[model samples]
Target chain A: MSSPLAKPQIIAHIQKSLNYTVFDSKWIPCSAKFVCLGNFARGTGVMQIYEVQHGEAQLVKEVEKPKPIKCGTYGATSLQQRHIATGDFDGNLNIWNLESPEVAVYSAKAHKEIINCIDGVGGLGIGDGAPEIATGSRDGTVKIWDPRQRDTPVANMEPIEGETKRDCWTVAFGHAFNDQDRCVCAGYDNGDIKLFDLRNMSLRWETNIKNGVCCVEFDRKDINMNKLVATSLEGKFHVFDLRTQHSTKGFASVSEKAHKSTIWQVKHLPQNRDIFMTAGGAGNLHLWKYEYPAQRSKKDSDGVDVGVAGTVNLLQNVTLSTQPIASLDWSPDKQGLCVCSSFDQCVRVLIVTKLNVV
Target chain B: MTAEEFVSLQNQGAVIDYNGKVPVEHLDYGYIEKCKDVKYLEKILKVLRSGEEGIYPDLISFCETRLELLDPKNRLLITDKPVTTAASLSKDEWGQIVDDLKMWQEESKKTEDSLKHQPLLNDIIKENIPPIRGSNQSVDIQQKQNKNHCKRPLPRDYQEWDKFDVEKECEQIDSNSSTTSDTPAIVNTGLSKLRTTLDASFLAEREQLNLATREKDKGNEAFRAKDYEEAIAYYSRSISILPTIIAHNNRAQAEIKLKHWNNAMKDCQRVLKMEPGNIKALLRRATVYTNTGRFETAAEDLRTVLKQEPQNPAALKLLSETELKLQDEGMIKKKRKGKKILIEEVDGDDGHNEKRQGGLKGEIFWVLYIINHLSHNLYNT
Candidate 1:
């Protein structure tokens, strides 16, 4: 076969030994610094900030916590603040100001069970909306909290009485640009995907993927609604077209098998809307691109308009270690630079080149 | 539904009466008022849909009432619906829309089935897409291939490769010309060329070594004369021709005399990369680190040197000096923290009594006394 037009090159720049099970890693916006949250051998969580200097990951600060941190994000705060919001195993949500590492600037008891996932939106001064945080918990609830309000959630979605509660696995905020028309997409262990419109206070849409949804993310948060990707436990992920909504059929989606094992997490490149990366339970990372259709919607046999979904093309795949990659985050400032934490007790800094070709 | 039927249904609490209509007396006043208000909106919408002008006052009132009704509670319920201004599309335009819709559906179906049997696309499409190269494949493959090719045996005898012998060919040409030409001028130029060629070949190794040694000697003479700049130039010339440990060492010494710490450090680092156990390079780099305020790195280098030669007095003294510098830095940091705490405590007491001037003086004295005591303890340690 002939070679492709533009092939990406993945360079493993640095690999640092954390000596602990790393759960999550995130890059600070507009900076070359990143924070890795892990659990030490003595059962304490540690958040360490490292700066990239001359191709070396130099440890700048380390903060120890009483509980294991499950996830973290800086998407809820401004770049100037550089506050890291983290959800721990104890269901407590804490936002730490890196400048003052002694205590959490904001702490709230968020859930009755372990907080499975956390995502933030409208921060970094990108949109006109107020900064909000969404937390998905094992208590079968997804709550949206405006950071300006302390100890209370602005909107909460819980299973109705007598309905069996399932573990809410992941939550993400989307469509929060311009005018505060925001939506929260949450995935549950029961293969349920719910998109709740924050502006209307209603369930915009819901579907069952028939497998435990591990992660769900929108292509971009600034647009009204473009695309939503949800990965499940059976090595399959579905990308839904959100532009056209049918009264009976909802959004059109296409499912593809990936990872050959449970897909753990998926992160879209901050620089390109079409490119994304998925971390697998079998210790593999795959780069993919979503090819858009020429037309976004079509009229069905019943004369009802239906949405058209794009296809995913796998560009690259590499196995970095034998353990599952727990989390991966792309740098917002740099095009193809990313940092990932795996179950192998190590954090790796990777550079993916030739992204501009796509 | 017609407007009157819609109003009748709404008035009946969204239910139809047994007689297919509601009694007039059972009608809600608010429902009647809302229905009457919506008639004006319906008329304005009809006019707008017809694409007519004039009746600006009616349109303005219609919009004002709609906004007032949707202002507070039903604000989010407002949606932008597509209002058809034109009557209908032409037959060609309708055909085009249908064709586009069909094409879009087909495209969507194709993508939906692209990954039916495999997690990734099939080999044909996958091959069409570019393959991302891993870090292992990013190095120069041509250079590696050339190296491998050089390591392999040639097809014929090495001496039989006449095309590779350019110098030998030049020599043969010179010899032939010298034999053919009998004129003195021609012979002189040819002989000069031959002599230059011979000199070039001879100087390739033996003569260059001698010249480099002479330059080193010149550097030593300049160094003894205290002309450090001239000495450095001579040493650089010797090293550029043929680098030697002595020349680099002398150049580094000259750079030190000039207080060019960075240049001296680079020379020392180059020497260390070549000879890991060179004591002079290690000592020079350690001194450079100390001068640059990198006490920790200096102490590390000094300790490494001491490990090799325990009785080295210079290493031991420099190690102690680095230790003292590190302790002083720590003392300063602790003093700042202590002073901050003392000031906070004094401020808190002052908040209770602003007139406590004597108490403030006493607090200041205690802060100074504690800082001095802490510094003394740190130095003793």
Candidate 2:
């Protein structure tokens, strides 16, 4: 498989001495709107949502959180409703409705330490009602919550060994492919990745990398395959093939030291299953493509596993900033369009030429 | 020279007349070369060799120089003349000839200079020197060294001359006559008008430039306001009057904002094509590259920008970003080990940092703080 080569072009530039520093951002799926959060230095809350327009991005709404917001996500559902969920430094998780332009739909202090990551997927494990949100934090715990019950979490997953806790940096979930319960993946500072099967409330699998894992992402668009990508502090990226039982059969290294500093975030392209983008601590965003090698025979020769694909190649790379890029999300309508927030006090839109790769 | 040639030249209003003849004795070398007719050359020689005892010594010397031209073996040709020469003769012989000619020329000058006081001498001479003819008519020579010696004969018609004398006497009696009153005024006004016309054309050219500058500034201000349509209107108006690069760049920026990508690209390409090394055009093209998803190309533009201005913040930022995106793990590791890559990079800005003093404040302060903290060592040596 050959890596896809893409060219990145900057669309617009805005220079303002913003009151707060950007920590994370998310594109509202299927819409031109997105939300970002940081500290609004003059005593206002950290999270703000800006609507992209023809002239410039405008501050459409701002939500007050208990502490600095580290990450944010949007649930897969309606576009016009403006449902946004955010995790803050104080370990408080909040979801807001931007449709009214100003209303907090859900709020709770969910963790004892800084909340590192938050994600949501509706109409599945929640029994076809409201969307369920998941948050991971430095307190070494992952919590699943439904907005209806504002106080206690629906379920919580902690490490089984009870060893000294490592900060949980990111969390992701996807519905099982063959009548299995939904699995949650959490990445920690100790370079360990833990997956939890919510149906049995038991540990599913664990893997150790050489560096602290900063972000984790499941290929949400891939309905038939079990693939997960993770980015670590040392700029190492890992892709797992969870379809088979062999622990080592599915893993592939995308690249190592791809960024100068920490790898802050990784996201699967919303429309393309084999495409993804990663953010760096040094303020750059790189887009990548993974392709499965062509098979030669009905029965493959690799002895360990029958369905394992060998190596992955990086296709396109783009730098969206000069300061550390903390988070990134792709535009739902455009296959190659992605947005990133950086320490440079700006959000940039990058366009890629080729996202659909074999 | 023919009288008709002089008449024709005068009719065409030629300021400097070439056909006009100068006195044979006073002709300089420059005019002699301009007279190319061989027939007139013979006539001049005949006139020179036929000189009587009272012929001017100046004319005789002029004839001798022309005579030497006949001897090709002597490196001089006939009809070729010299205005002045120093022959290596014994002192007594050359000194006597020089003394005699010097005296004659001085006597002729005195007579000419006093013609205003003794008008009879002007009549006796008709002209101080004899007229030259045909190809030997060297008027430019007379103008160069002997213009003052060439006397023009006063109007020879005796009746008309007497009438001019009588009119002058009458003007003294009736000083209020209209002709007398208006003559000086017309002469003075004509002189002043000529001077003004010469100066006005130069001033007009400068004023045109000033007007163009004012119009351009108006257009530039409109561009700064982000009203691209209005700005374009103003820019077009200014460009029609006088085109400039600043206006072109402004129009290109506005076009990009309107998503007229091709138009913007063409404008930038035009500017750079006209002036390939223009800093502004290069920067504008760099931005266009970024927008078009040509990050590698954009990096080349930024590199050029940096070479010209080493501390250019925009170029540096863009360059670092592009490098980060281009990071392949193997390549990064190879580059880190300092292997020379064959990438053809663009020239960056020169080493002059514009905000050198101002930018160093934060970075320098941090460095100093670290040094101060380190000075207080936990382990006392």
Per-model root-mean-square deviation over C-alphas: 38.3, 51.6
lDDT of 1 by residue, B276-295 (tens): 96887788788888888888
Best by DockQ: 1
Write candidate 2's Cα lDDT for B217-334 as tens digits. 4344334433355445545544554556776777677777777767777777877877776777777777777777676787788888888999988778777877676565447665
DockQ of each: 0.01, 0.00
The true-versus-predicted C-alpha distance at residue B229 of model 2, in Å, is 56
Q: Per-residue lDDT for A1-358 in model 2, tens only? A: 3231233222222222356787777766434556777877664456666655542467777766556777777762322244677788788887766655355677898899988888875421111123566788888778887655666777776544545667888888764322234567788888888776654565656778868988888875212224688888887788765444443332433444466678888887665545677777766655566655453112324434333443554444445556777767776544555677778887765544434433
What number of clashing residue pairs does each candidate have, in the order they appear? 0, 20
Model 2 scores what on Cα lDDT? 0.56
Report the CAPRI category for model 2: incorrect
Error of 1 at A333 (Å): 0.2
On TM-score, the leading prediction is: 1
- Give the per-residue lDDT digits (tens) of candidate 1, residues A157-274: 8876677789999998887634447788999998999988777676777899999999999976754456799999988889987867876688879877756788999888775667
